[model samples]
Target: MHIAAANREDDLQRLHEQITQTRLAILVTHNEQGLQATHLPVLLDPQQGAKGTLLGHLARANKQWQALAEGAEAMLVFAGADAYVSPGFYPSKLEEPRTVPTWNYVAVHAYGRAEVFHDAERLLDIVSRLSDRHEAGRATPWSVGDAPADYIASMLRAIVGFSLPIERLQGSRKLSQNRSAVDVEGVRAGLANSPDPLDNQLAALMRQP
Candidate 1:
């Protein structure tokens, strides 16, 4: 990602939160065939400090998993929120028509080496963690153990479990950081007033000092 100086997020904790908050991420890889990507919901395991691993599963029929192996490098992208920033929103635009339109968004990039785990027990663990994390916030939480043993096992077989041990982490928070304070406020208000909840949430984030 081409993150401008004003938009860069260098704090590790901030970057980590962005990754953890996002449930879905795009996993990308490069090979002889060129670039390949897969969209998946992921769990970020922060046991290894900055070198955390991303856990997720791929359908057995998915060829993207086939291309990954132990130590295969991959990138995981976590998108926070985005909104269009009109030039009219910029306070400076009232003074002159010099500023161009832009976007306000945040994203985190994780680079890692993958190790595919096929063991039934490991699969069960991964699935359980994913389930628990997602259900933690729900009023009626569910669990992997709630279903029949055989049925859960059968379901697990239809997919493959893997972990990407992170090697590099980068983040960008382009929330009109390059704009003047007045323009920033304008963008925030524009996003906050949007119909999309995500845009509203993003605006709130941008409003943070």
Candidate 2:
């Protein structure tokens, strides 16, 4: 990712927070046929490696999993809110009309070698933890035990799990940080007033200190 100095976000805590906030990631891998991508709901184990480890699963019927050898290269792309920016929102546009429209977004890229596993026990633990995490705060939370034991076991057999110990992490948050304070305020105001939900989301991120 080509991140401008003003947009670069390398802070460890912030990066992990971004990953946790966006549980679903696009897992990218390559094989003989070509590149393949899967949308995976992953759990991040922050203490497991130099950076951290990502845990996720794919359906057994998915050919993408069949390409995963012992240690295959992979990347997890986590995307946050994004919105379109118009030069009309910038105060500087009056003085310097050369400004053009742009898009603002937040994203994290994780690169590492992936390890695949099919052990029923490990798969069970992974599914159970993911369930508990997402089900929290619901009026009635569901757990893996809610299903019949044999049913759960049978379901687990239809998927494959993988672990990726992150070797590197890159984060970028382009929220008009490069713009002048006055212009940024104008942009935020314009976005906040827009009816689009994504625009409102970007405006909210810009409010962060």
Candidate 3:
């Protein structure tokens, strides 16, 4: 991603926080055939490596994993809040009459070398962690052990686990940072008042430094 200096996000903790908040990531890889993507619920192990490690799985039937055999690098994309920015939102636009509409959004990209672990024990551990991460927010959390042992084993066998130790992390928070203070406030107010929840989210992001 080509991130402008004003929109670049360099804080590691902030980037990881966004990763944790995102529900799913689009994992991208290049195979001998071509580029492929899979939407996956990935776990971030912040302490696992120099950067961090990603834990996720794909169904055994998924051919996307076959690309790993050729040692392909992987990229996981996490999308955040986004909204439409109307030129009318900027008071300066009224005077200049040259401004155009644009989209304001936030996204993170993680690059790494992926390793597949298509075994029972490792798969069990990965799935258990993933389950715990999601369940922690519930009033009554679920666990991998809640299911029948045989059933859990069968499910694990049907999926293949993988780990990507993130080598590089990039974050883009393209709010209206390039605009004037008055114009930025105008954009924020417009988005904050929008009926769309996502627009409110994008507006909320504008309040942060």
Candidate 4:
């Protein structure tokens, strides 16, 4: 979230869409035990408010929820395409030998107040959407009712659902935006030729104006 002005994305709609596409995010919080981080699939609902809100659930056994409260602030980090940028890939490195290795990536940070919900109805809605999103492309898509009704309800009772009302949105596109146009082009070409799928994806993002 420490974004330079040149790379910052201030558009709320675009940022929210990017969040929705992100399959996973790291939720960070502070507590008496110090910093605690949890990786989960979170959905950002723009319909809730102007700043949007994050919805997700955690296991009942997971103690991270105890630290989250109505007014407590937490950070949810969504990572997009990213890859290692070798100086060897930069065209300028060959001519001037001044370039150093760095990383090219895109990420968004949402800081907000968390509100934990235990209501069965809300939890049902949350779980249904989450399951549908993950199973969207599957040939044999699974639904909440695939399991026994009582079993599903019991399972839901064991987990905790929560919402983080985002108060701040920050984004960064570090796709060699600081490099010279010539260097960026070289990097983009190099990444496109990489064997790594993530590298190729990052190269595609770099093509954006």
Candidate 5:
């Protein structure tokens, strides 16, 4: 991602927060055929590597995993709240009429070497952890052990696990920080009143100090 200096998010903690908040990520890779992308929920292991490690799984039938080579690099994109910014929302637009529409969003890109594995034990552990992470907040949290032993084994056999040891992390948070104070306030007011919940969420983010 081409992030301007003003929009660049350099805080490692903030980047990690964004990744954890948005568990789903777009994993992209290239092969002889062409580029391919898969959306999956990724778990971060902050203690696993210098930066961090990402764990996720893909269906055994997915051709994307077949393209992975040892030490090959892949990118995982995690997106947070995003909304459209209208030119009318900028106070300067009424003064000079030079303002244009833009988008406000938060995103993080993680680059790492891809490693594919099919170990049943490792795959089961990955699945169990993933399940626990997502199900923790539920009133009736279901677990991998809730299913029959043979059923769980059958399910695990149909998927493959992978890990990506993060080598680089880049983040961008474009929330109208480049605009004038008046324009920023104008945007916040306009988005806050918008009917879309996502717009309201972005407005809240914009108001943060």
Candidate 6:
């Protein structure tokens, strides 16, 4: 993305946090036919490679997976809290009336060559890790072992696993940093009292220095 220097995020820890907190990612790839995208929950292995690696799966019937050639380039987009910033939220809007509405959001873009695997054992491991991560907060956590072996094997057979060793990572956090202090505060105050949960979340993020 075209992230201004003021809004660019280069901290590795912060980028990893954003990716993990926003578990779902939009995986984009292109081929002879055209471009394709899939929304999937990705697990990041921070120690896997020079930057990191992303793991996820798709249904065996998903044409997107079949469309990917060996060592194909892919991009994963992870989005965090975002909200509309109204021109009225700027304190100078009433006096100058030059401001226009814009969107405030946090996002990370990861580029890598995707490697697809269909081995049952690898698929089981991926499924197990994903289950543990998502179910840890539940009152009764479920595990791959909780199901019958045959059933688990059958389910694994219906999906394919893929890993992308990240070659490049870029992040952007546009949180009204370019605005004047008064305008930033105005945005925070306006979003803080809004009824939308996402707006309130964005307000909290904007408060972070």
Tell me, by lDDT, which candidate is best: 3
Give lDDT tens digits, candidate 3, residues 108-147: 9999888988889989998898899889989999999999
lDDT of 1 by residue, 87-144 (tens): 9888788788888878788999998778887788888888898899889988889999
For candidate 6, write residues 1-209 as lDDT tens digits: 89999999999889999999996899998877588899999899999998889999999888788665455688999999999999989988889997889999999999988889999998999999999999998999999999999999999989989988999999999999999999999999999999999999999998887
Off by over 4 Å in 5: none
Residue lDDT tens for model 5, 1-209? 99988899988888888899997899998877588899999899988888889999999888788766544578999999999999999878866987789999999999987789999999999999999999998999999999999999999889988988999999999999899999999999999999999999899989776
- Candidate order by lDDT, highest to lowest? 3, 2, 6, 5, 4, 1
State the TM-score for model 3: 0.96
Looking at candidate 5, the ten consecutive residues that score lowest on lDDT are: 64-73
lDDT of 3 at 183: 99
Span of 10 residues, lowest total lDDT, candidate 4: 64-73
TM-scores for all predictions: 0.93, 0.96, 0.96, 0.95, 0.95, 0.96
In model 2, which runs have C-alpha deviations exceeding 4 angstroms? none
